[model samples]
Target: MPWSPALKSTLRSGLHLERTVTEPFQVLRGMLGVAIVLFGALALGETGLATSAALGAFIAGTASYQRSFRPRPVLALYAAAGLSASSFVGYLASPWPPLYVVVLGLWAFTAGLAWALGQTAGVVASTTVSVMLIVVTLPENVPEALEHAGVIALGGVVQATLAAIWPGRRWGARRDALADAYASLAHYARRLRHDPFASFDPDPLMNARRAAELTPAQARRRPSELAGMRSYAERIRPVLAAMADPRVGAAEEGPQRDRARELMGAAAEILDAIARSIRSGRPAPIAERTYRALTVPGSGPVLDGAGRQAALRLIGLLAEASDAVEAVDRGDPVHGEANAPGHLSRPGLRQLLPVLPHALRRHWNWSSPVLRHAVRVGVVAAVGEILGRSLPFQHGYWAPMTAVMVMRPDFSQTYARGVARLAGTVLGVVVATGIIRLTHPSAWICAGLAVVSIGGAYLLMRTGYAAMSTCITGYVVFLLAMGGEANTSTVEDRVLLTLLGGLLALIAYAVFPTWQTVRLPDRLAAYVEAGGRYSAAAVDAYAEPTEHSRALLRAALLEHRQTRAELLTASEQAAGEPVRHRGLHTAQLADARSAMAALGRTTMLMEAHLPPPQSSPVPGAAEFAEVLREQTAAAARAIRADEPVDLHALRDHYEQWAQWLPTPAADPADEPGGAADLVYRDAGLLVEALEGLDSALNS
Candidate 1:
C-alpha cells in the first residue's frame, strides 16, 4: 500500500458519515442537563460561571453517550471530577510557563495510558486534558480558579442528579444489548439454511455478556426475562451449528437435512420474536405454525441419530426462551442464583480501588501499545503547547486541544480524526461567525444556541467522527460567544490554529508510528495459542468428564472467542496502514485465518458430542491432550519470535495416540456416531488444521 492511496482512503473513511439511528429522547435528556447549568448560571448574572459549568455539563453528557455499560450517572460524575481536577491543576500551573508545560505533558501521557482501561475511560480522560487547556485561561487568580473549578464540578453534579432522578427507560442499554445477541442468532439461523457451514459472529453475544455484568444493587432488581435468556442464547448457538453441519448432525442430502433446515427457519422466527419482546418490553406472540414446526410429527418422516438429538435440544432451548418472555410479561421475580453461568459480576465503584493499580501496571511495560501511545501523546502535546504559545494567536490552547483530541493509538484513527477535526472546525467557525454577524445574538441567545448545538452533537455521536466533530465545534463556539469572544478574527484564528494542531498531531504520528503491521504476528500467535487451549480442553473432557472439566472447557472456549475477535480487529486496522512489515503477507494471513477457523470449528463439532459425566474414559485421551497443549504452546512461541511453526511432532504424536485408541465394533450399527469414533475423527481434523497453520506460517 502506497502512502498516497492509503492517505486518501483514511481521509475518505474519516469523512464518511454513518447512518446511525438517532435517539431523540436520549438527546433531549442530555440537553436538559446542559440547559440547567447554562441557563441557571446565566439567570444568576454569572456569565463566567455559566461558561465553566456548561463545559462540564456538556462533556459529562458526552461521556454518558460512550459505549459503556456503567451507570450513566457514574460516568457523568467521573467525567466531572476529572474535569474539575484538571482545571484546578492547569490554573495553578498557568503562572509558570515551564512548569505548566511539564504538567501538561504528564497529564497528556496519563490520559493516553487510560486506553488500557477501555475506550470509554480513554476518551473521557482525554477530554479532561482538552477541558483543562480551555478553562485554565479563564480564571485570573487562585480564588477565582477555585470558584471556576467548583462550578465545573457543580455541572457534573447537575447532570448526575438529573440522570439519577429522571432515568428514561431504565436498563435500556442492557435490553438493547441482549436483543442484539438474539437478533444476531436469528440472522445466523437464516444464513445457515443456505450456507450450512457459515460462521456465526460472536461480537453481539460478547457485547451482551458485557452488558450482563452487574453490580450487587443491579442484580437485586434485574428483570426476570433478562436473567436466563442470554445463557440460553449462548447454548443455542453451538447446537444450531451442530444441526446444520453434515459431518456431525444431518446427512448431506436426505430427509434429515430437510428437517434441519425447517427447524432452523422456525428457530429464526422464534428468535426474532424473543428479540422484539426483549427490546420492546412486551411479549411477542409466537406464531402457531412456528411452534408446530418444532414438534416431531407422528405421521411424517422423522429425524434420527445426531440430527434428532440436535432438534430436541433446539426445541428445549426455544421453549425456555419463550417461558422467559412470558415471565417478563407476568412481572415475575428473577430466578436462580446471582452467580449463575453466563451472568457476570462487576464490583462497585469503591470496590474498584484495590483493582486499579494492577490494571494500570499491566500497560506500563514498553511492549504495550498503550505505553508507546502515552509517550507519543506526551511529547506531541508538550511540543504543540509550546508552539501554540509562541505563535501570535490569542487562544493558543486550541492547538494542543486539537492535537490531544485527534491523536489515537493507531495510525488510521489518528490521521482520520485529524482530517475530520480540521474540516469540522472550518465549517463550524465559518457558520458560527456568519450567524453572529447576521443575527447579532446576545449573551443569553448564545447560551441557548450552545445548548442546541450540544443536543445536536449528542444525536450525531454515532454518525462518524466527522459529523459529531462538527456539532462539537459549534457547541464550543457558542459557549465562547457567551463570554464575548465570537468575532470574525477569532474565527480565522480558530481555523488556522486547528489546521496547525492537526498537522502537528499527524506529523508526530508519522515520525513515531505504532504500525499494526508489526503486531500482526503477535495477534496471530495469540489466536493460535487460544485455539490450541480450546481444542485440548475439548478433548480432555472425554478423558475425565466432570463438572470441573466442563468448566475449564467453557473458559477455554471464551478465551478462544476473545482472541479470534481481537485478531480480526487487528487485521482490519492493519489493512488500512501503509507499512508492509516482514510479518505475514496477504495470502499467508488468509490461510492462517482459515486454519484457525477450521481448528475452532473442528473442536466445536467434537464438543457437541462430549460424553456424559461418569461415562467410560477414552484410553490415552489425557496423554494426547497434554501433548496437544505443549506442542501448540511451543508453536505459538515460535510464531511470536518470527520463526517457523513446526507441527510435525504434533502430527506424529496424534498418530501414536490414534494407534493406542480402542477399536470400534465390527458392525457400524452397533455404535453409530459413537463418542470414540467422533473423537478420533475430530482429532485427525485438528491435526490437519495445525499442519495447515504451520504451512501458512512457514511459507
Candidate 2:
C-alpha cells in the first residue's frame, strides 16, 4: 500500500469514520435536545429568542454524552446550572469591550481548569465555552440580555425535561456493553486456540469495561450486573493469557491438547450465544452441552504442576463467566459482591466551599498541566478576542471561539488539531454552501438540518476533533439560516476566521508548550505506585479478614486499574505525536509498556489466588506482604527519579517466601484445614507474581 500524507495523518491521529458513532443513543439524545429547542423556538417565530434558544440547545446537547452513575435528576440539575452560569457570564460582559475580553479570557481559563476533573467534565466545559461565545454576541442592551437569558433558561429546561422523558435506550447501552464483553472473551479464546504465542489487543476489552463503567446501577438488567460483567472481563483476559503459556501448550499436544482446545471452543460458543442473547434483549438458556463439557472430568494428558494450574484457572474463569450470564438472565444480583461506591460525590454549594482552597492549590501549581494550560488559554483568548473585535469581520466571535476550541494542553495536540480544524472548517463551509444553494430549504428544514449537524458533531467527537469541527461548522451555518441570515459570503467569512483562529492557536501553543514525552515517566511512576498500593491491599485482605479490609482492597484495585489505563492511553498519544525536539526514547517506552503488561498479569494471578478472610494468617505472610510493598514502592521511586531499579535485591528478598509453597511429597492432611492453607497458597502466589513483575521491570 502506498502511503500518502493524508493516510499518514489519519494513522497518526487514529482517525476512522467507522468510529464516528460510539453510541447511537447518545447521538440521538443530543439531537432530540436540539430538535426540542428548535421546535419551541420556531413555533414562537421570534428570531432573537430563537437564536438564544438554539445556542442553549447546542450547549446542553453537546453534553449529552456525559455519563455518570448518578441519578437522572441530579445530573440534569447539574447540566442546567452549567448552562445558566455560562449564559449569564456571556450576557453580562458583552456591553463593555474591556470587560468582554477580560471575562471571556477568564472563562476560558476556568474551562481549562475543568480538565482536572476528567474527560467528561472537559467536554461539558468546552460546550459551555462555545455557548458563551454565541450568547455574548446577541445584542448589547439590558432588556435584550434579560430576554435572551430567559429564552436560554427555557431552552435548558426543555433539554432537561426531554432527557428525563427519553434518556435514549438505557437497556440498549447495557446490552451492547455486555455483549461486547462476551465477544471480546470469545475472540481471545479463539486466538489462543489458534496460536499460543499470538498477542491480543486490550482496546476491545477496555471499551467493554468502559461501557459497563458508564452504566448506572439502576439501569442494568440485574443488580450489580455491570460490575460483575466488568470483573469477569478483567479476570478472563489474564486467565486466557495464562492458558496460552508455551509450557502448557507444549506439554500436551495430543489427547490433552485436543480436549483443552475442545473445551475452549465450547466456551467460545457459549460466550457467543450469551452475546447474541444480550444483543437481542432476551434471556437465552445456557447451553447444556457447554456446561457438561466443563463439568466432565479430565480424561487426557498428564501435566506438570504449572500446566495443571493454568488449565484449572482457565476452567474456573469459564465457569465464572457462565455464572455471570445466568445471573443476568435470572435477574439476580451477579457475583454477590457489592459494587464500589461513588468515588467523587456530586458536589453541593456547601461542599464546594470547603474544597475551594484545596482545589485551587492542586490545580494552580507549576507541576499541574491544567494550570499551565489555563494560563495559556487565558492569554491567547484575550488576544483572539481583541483581534476579532479589531478586524471588520462580521460574526467575529468565530475567531475567539475557534481559538478557545483549538488550543489544547500540549503542543502536539494543539498543533495537530489546529491543522485539522482549519481544513475541516474550509471543507464544511464549502459543503454547507453547496447544500444551501441546491436545496434552498425553508426555515423549518434549516432548523432540522442544524439539529442533525449538532448530532453528527458529537457523534464524531471521540474519533477526532477535526471531524467534529466539520459537523459543527455546518451546524452553525444551518443555525444562522434558521434565523434568516445565512449567505455565500457567510461561508467565506467562516472559512477565513477559522483559519486565522487555528493559526493563532498553533502559535500560542508553540509559545507556551507542555510536552507529553517529558511527562510520560512521571505518569509511569504513578502507575507503579498505584500498582504497589493495590498489591499491598490484596495481601492485607488475606492477613486479616474484615469488611473494611475488603473495601480497601476493592478501592485499591480500582485505583490501580484506572492508573494503568491512563498510562496506556497516554503512551498511545505520545507515540502518535510528531517527534521534533522531544525526548521520546522508543526503546524505553516499549520497556515501560512491557513492564506494565507483566505487572497486570501478575495482579490478575494474585486476585485469582486471593483467599477468603481467615481467622488467622500464616506468620510469615506479613513479612512477604512487606517485601512486595517495599519492592514496588522502590521501583516507583526509581522510575520517577530516573534511576535503574535493582531487581537482584528484590528477587533475593522474595526467595524467602518460597518456603510457604507445598512440597512435592506434602499432603493436604498435614496443613490446617481452611484459613492456614488458604493463607499459605495466597502468600506463595503473591510472592511469585511480585518476583515476575520485578524481573519484567528490571529487564
Candidate 3:
C-alpha cells in the first residue's frame, strides 16, 4: 500500500488497452451523426457554428456508447440539452471574468454531484462543463450565442434522429445480456462436473435483469422469445447447485454421483445451445445425445430424494427453453408469463423529471462520496481557471476543462486518468500538428480530417481512455485548424495546458481523498444484512408455502446478490489505496468472505427444495425464521459498530426448533423427502454458517 507501488499500479491500469468486442456498424452509425452536423454547418459557411455543433454531436454520440439499458436516443437528447444550456450560460457570463469563474465553479460542482444518478449521467454532465468552457470563447454577442446554442442542440437532434431510424439490431443488447446469463450457466455446469462446490458469478444474471426492464411501450412490443426466458435461467441456477452439491444431492462418490455428473454435462451442452440460439435469434439446435442423457430410462441408475427432484426440474426447464425457441422459429405468440421476481420498472424520460430532485437530495450528505467529489471538483475547477488565466496561454480555458473531465471520486481513477490525458494530449498534438504543417490542408480538408478523427475516437472508445483521448485530441486539433488556429505554438500550448490541468486535478484528489478502505466495513455489513434476509426468507417459505412467500424469497436473493457484488467491487477498488486501515486484517477479510459465501450457498440449497403450493407447513419454522432475521440484523449492526458479532440467540432458537420437530426415521426407506424434513436438515447447515460468520467477525 505504499505510494510508489500504488502509483505504479494505477499508471499501468491507465495505460492498459483492452481488447473489446467491436461493433463496426454501430460505430459507423454514431459517426454519421457527427458528419452530418459538421458538413451541414460547413455548407452554411459558419466555421464557428460548425465547430460548436460537431462538438455537441461528438459528445452526444459518446454518451450513447455508455453501458446503459436506456434508449440511446434519449441519452443523446439529455446530453444535448445539458450542452446547450451550459454553452448559453457560459456565453452570458463571459463578459465579467469574476462572474464567469463563479458560474464555472458552481456548474462543475453540479456536474460532479450528478454521479449520484449514475456513471452515465456523471460523464454526460461533465461533458457539459467542458462545453461551457470551450464554446463560451466563440460567440461575440447575445444573438450569435443563441445561434450557437441552437445549432448545438440541433446536433443532438440529428444524433437522436439517426439512432431512432437506424438502430442496427433491435433488442440486441438485451439479447446479448440474456445470452450471457445462459452462457455463464453452461460454464458453471461444466465446472461443477469437475468441482462439485464451485462458485458461480451472478454478474451476467444481474445484467440480464437490468436489460429486462422496459418502458410500457417496449414491454408491449417485446419479442415472444424473450418472454419468460430470464425467469427460467434464474430458476435453473440454484437447482444446478443443489444437484452438484454432495450435501444436498448425491453422495461423494457413487452411481448417484456419476449420474449427476452426466446430467450436468448434458445440461451444459443444452445451455450452450440455448445461449447460441438466443444470441443469434435462431432456433436452438440441441444434440440428440444431450436429449437422450436427460431423458429418463426404465433401467438406469435411480436418483433419489433431492437429486431426483433436481433432475426433474432441470428437464422441465430445458423443455421450456426448447419450446420458446420453437415458438420463435414458428413466429407464434407464446403467451407464457413474462413477469420475473425482482423485476425492475424503468420510467420514461418525462417520468424521470419528478424524481430527479429526490435522487439528487439522497446524496447531499458528508458521508456520500458523490458530495465530497462535487466539492473537490468545484474548488479545483475554480483554482485551475484562476491559474490558467494568470498564465500566458492563448486558450486558458483548456486547463480548467481538462481538470473537470479527468477528475473522479476515487484516487485510482483520478490519477490514472490524469496520466492518460497528459500522454494522449502530447501524442495527439504532435501527430495532428505534424499533419497540418506537412499538408497545409484547406479548411474543407481539415473538416473532413476532423470527421475521420471523430470516427476513430468512436471506434476506439472501449479500447482504453488513453486511446480514445488521443483520437479526441486529434479531432479537436483538426476542428480548430479549420478555424485557422493551426500554428506551431498551438501544440506547445495544448500539451502544457493539458499537463497543468491534469496535475491540478490529481493534486486536488490527493488533498481531499475519499478512500474506499474506510467504507469497507459498511459494505461488509450490508452484505451480512442481505445474507440474513435471504436466509430468513428461505426459512419463512417453509413455514408457509404461498406466492407471497416465493416473491419475498426471490427479492431477498436478488438483494443479496447485489450486495455481494458491491462488496467485491469495493474490495477491488480499496486494494490500490496508499493508506492501510487498522480494522479487519487480510485473513479475517478472507474468512468473512468465505463465511458469507457458505451462508448464501446453504440457503440456496434450501430454496432449491421449496415446498409446492398447498403443502403442509413445517412446525416451529416461523419462530425460528423470525429469530434468524433479528439475530442477523443485530449482528450486522455489531459489525458496523466494531463490536463482537454474537449469534447465540440464533443458534439457541435453531436447537429448540430441532428439538420440537419429530426425529427422522432410522430406515432410509422410511425417511420422508418432504419440505419439513428438508427444512430441518438445512437449518442446521444455516446455523453453522452463521456461527462461522460470528467467529470470523469476532476474531
Candidate 4:
C-alpha cells in the first residue's frame, strides 16, 4: 500500500485534489446563463431565452478556443444564422408552428440554391445547414418557447452585426489590430537579432498563422491594409529567412548581433509606417529615403564591412518595394495595374472547375446528411408532442437538433463533444436539484446562473472532449427552471436527454464520416505549385538594386505561408484516412516547409550585393530585367517541383531581355505596363542570376 516511486513523485508535486472542484459562485453562474436564455426569450421580444443562451454560450466558447475573434465578418454572420434558426424552431413549436417551419424552410432552400450558384457557396452552405437542423429540433409549446426564441435571435443579430462592421464603425478598432500586428512583428525581429537561429523553429510561422487566422477581416483587405494580408506576409519572409540561416545564428560575435539588431530596428520602422497608413486610411507611401535604403542584402543581420553595405542595399530594396506598394495604392503605373508586367500571373478560375470535384467528392454525405437531420427534427418534435400529451411535462424538437448540433466533424470530435455533453448535462441536473432544494429560484437567480454558465463554457471550450458537456449540463437545469416553476426537481430528464443527444452525435460522426476529406492527388498537385512559387521567388531575389529584391522576398514569404496552411488542411483531410499513412502526410508537410524556408534564406544571402551598374544594356535590352526576373523565378520552381520549367523558352526570353536593357531608347514611362523600374545598376545584378543559370545549365 506504500507509495511507489512514481506515486511518490506525484505526491511531492504539491498538487491538491480539492483544486479540481469549481467554486460555488462559478457553478451558480453556469446555471444562470442557461436559465436566462430560456427565460430571457420572454423579455428579449423574439429569440427564445433558451435559444439565446445556447447560441451565446456556443459563440463565447468558440471565441475562447480561437483566442480571439478578429476573423469576424463571417463568424458574426454564422452566429446570426444560429440565432435565426434557434428562434424559428421556437416558433415552429407552439402558438403558430407552420409559420416557423415555412420561414425557416424557405430561407434554407433559397440560400442553398444560391450557394449552388454563387462564389461564396461555402458561407451560404454553412449557414443554411445549421439553421435547418435547429428548426427541426425545436422544443414544442414548452411554455413561452416562442418568446424565448425571438429574444435570443434578436440579441445575437444585434451583437454579431456590431462585430461585423466594427472596424469601419467603431472608430479606432482597425488601427488597433494593425498596430498590434506590427508591434508583434517588431518584437519578434528584435528578439531574432540576438539569436536568429535560436528561434529558428516554426514558432514565427505559427504565430503569423495564428495572427492571420485570428485578426478580424479589417486587417487583410485594403490596398493600404497590408495588401489583403499578402504583403504583410511578403515583408516578413526575408526576415524569417535571414534569421533561419545557420551562419546568422552561428554568429555569436557581438558586432554581428548589433548590426542585425540595427537592421531589424529599421525594418520595424517600415512596418510601423504601414500600420500608421492603415490607421489613417491613407496610401502607405514608401518615402524616397527608405525606398533608397533597401538595396543591400545579407544572409543574416547586417554585419561590419560588407554587412553594412548589405544592410543599406536591403534598406533600398525594402524602400522601393514599399514605394511599389504605395504606387499600387495610388494607382501608379510604374509597377503596372493589378498585373506585374512581363510575367502576368492572373487568376485562372476555369482551372478551379476541375479542382471543385476534388473537393466536393469527399463530402461525407453529398445529399442525405442534411435531409436526415431535418427528418430527425420533425420526428423528434412530433413524438415529443405525443409523449407529453398525456403528461404534465412539455416537449419539443430541441432534443433532436441538439443531437445534430453537437455531432462531430469526424469521429474524434464527435466522441469528445458527446462525452462532454453527457458530463455537463449530469452536472447541470445536480445544479437544478440544488436550486429546487433552495426553493423556487427568482429571475435574478436565473440571470446569475446564466452568467456563470457562460464563463464556464468559455473556459472549457479549449479543453475539448469535456467542454460542451460540462457547460451544457448546467445549462439544461437552468433552462428547465425558467418555466416559472422550480422544475429543477426534474433534473433527471434533462440529463437523460443530454445523454441521448451525445449517443446520436456519435452515430452521425461514425456512420458516413464526411467532415475532413480531400483527394490526395489534388493535394499533391497543389503542393507542387506551392513549392514552385517558393523557388521562383527565391531566384527573383538575386536581382540587383533594391526594388526587385524586395518583391521577390515578399512573393516568397506569402507563397510559403499559403502552402503551409494548405498542407495542414490536407493533413486534416487525411486524418484517419483509410488508405494513407498519417506519417507520410506529416512528412509531406515537413518537406514542403523545409524547402520553403531554405529558399527564403538562400535568396536573401545571394541578393546581398547592391553594386553600381555596369554599362547600359545592348540594343533592345530594356526589357531584360523583367524577363530575367521571370527566368530566375521559373528556374527556382523547376528545382522544387515535379513540374519542369520550359528551360529553352525561358533562356531565349532572358537572352532577348538582356539585349533590350542597357541600350534602352524608349521612355521607361511609355515602354510597357507593369515593368520593374530598374536603372543601369539594378539590371546589372539580375544579369548575374540569368547568366549564372545559363552557365550552370545551358553551357
lDDT of 2 by residue, 1-699 (tens): 122443366345533344545577767777777777777778888666677787776665555555543334344445556766777777777778899888888988888887776666665676677677777666567677777777776666766677778766555555676678778778877877877645556555555654544333343333344445566666666566555544323234665566557667777887787677667655466667877766646653343343445556667776776665566666664332224421122344466577756776787888677888888887878888898778877777788778887777765566666777777777877798678878989888988888888888878877776688788889878877765566635677777778788778877766676756567877787887787778777667667656777778777866776787777767765654554223335666666656555555445544544444655554555565677778778877887776776545545655555555445323322332233443444444445555554555555
Error of model 2, residue 530, in angstroms: 3.1
For model 4, what is the alpha-carbon lDDT of residue 463?
A: 46
Please provide, for model 4 over 1-699, each residue's C-alpha lDDT reduced to its tens digit, 9 standing for 90 to 100. Answer: 122442333232212112234334433433333344445553653333544445544442232123232433344445545555545554554354555444544444333233232223423333333443433344456444554444445444444444444323232443445445655555655566655643233334344343433222223232334334333433454444443243422245666655556566567667666556655656565455543334344463345433444454445555554564455466543322343222123223364477655544433254433333333333333333333333443332334434544442333344444555566556666765676557666655654565566566545543443554556545444544454434523555555555555555555444544433334333434543444454444444333324665566456555655655655665654553333432224444355444434433444443343222342223333244345445545654553453433435544655555554444424322321112223232333334333443333322
Per-model lDDT:
0.86, 0.65, 0.86, 0.44
Residue-by-residue lDDT tens digits, candidate 1, 1-699: 778988998899889888894688889888999999999999998888888999999999888878899999999999999999999999999999999999999999999988988899999999999988989978889998998899898999888888889888888999999999999999999998898888778899989989999876787777777887898898898889878888667777778888889999999999999999999888999899998898878853356666667778789899988897888778676655677545688888788877778888988787777888889889888998998899998788888999999999999899899999888878887887778878989999999998888888889888888778888888888888888877635677888888888999999889988888888888988999999999999888988888789889999988998999988988888889998867679789889999888888788777766777887777777878888899889988998897878889988887777675577544323453454574556788889989999888888
The TM-scores, one per candidate, come to 0.97, 0.82, 0.97, 0.54
Candidate with better lDDT, 1 vs 4: 1
Q: Model 3, range 1-699, lDDT digits (tens) per residue? A: 989999999899889898983588878887889899998999999999999999999998888878998998989999999999999999999899999999999999999999988899999999999999889988999999999999899999889889899988888898899899999999999999989888889999999999988765677667776777888898899899988898778777988889999899999998998898888888778889988989887863367777777778888888887787678888786343335332457788778888889977898889888999999999888988898899998787779988998999888898888888878878998899899988999878988999888888888888888898898989988888888877635678878888889999988988889998888888899999999999999988878888899999999999999999989987888898898768766677779999989899888787777887677787778888888888889988987888888998887777766765677644222343453465456888889988999889878
lDDT of 1: 0.86
Backbone clash total, candidate 4: 77
Give candidate 2 misplaced runs (Cα > 4 Å). Answer: 1-16, 19-32, 66-77, 194-257, 285-288, 298-361, 431-452, 455-467, 481-491, 536-553, 579-584, 656-699
Clashing pairs in 3: none
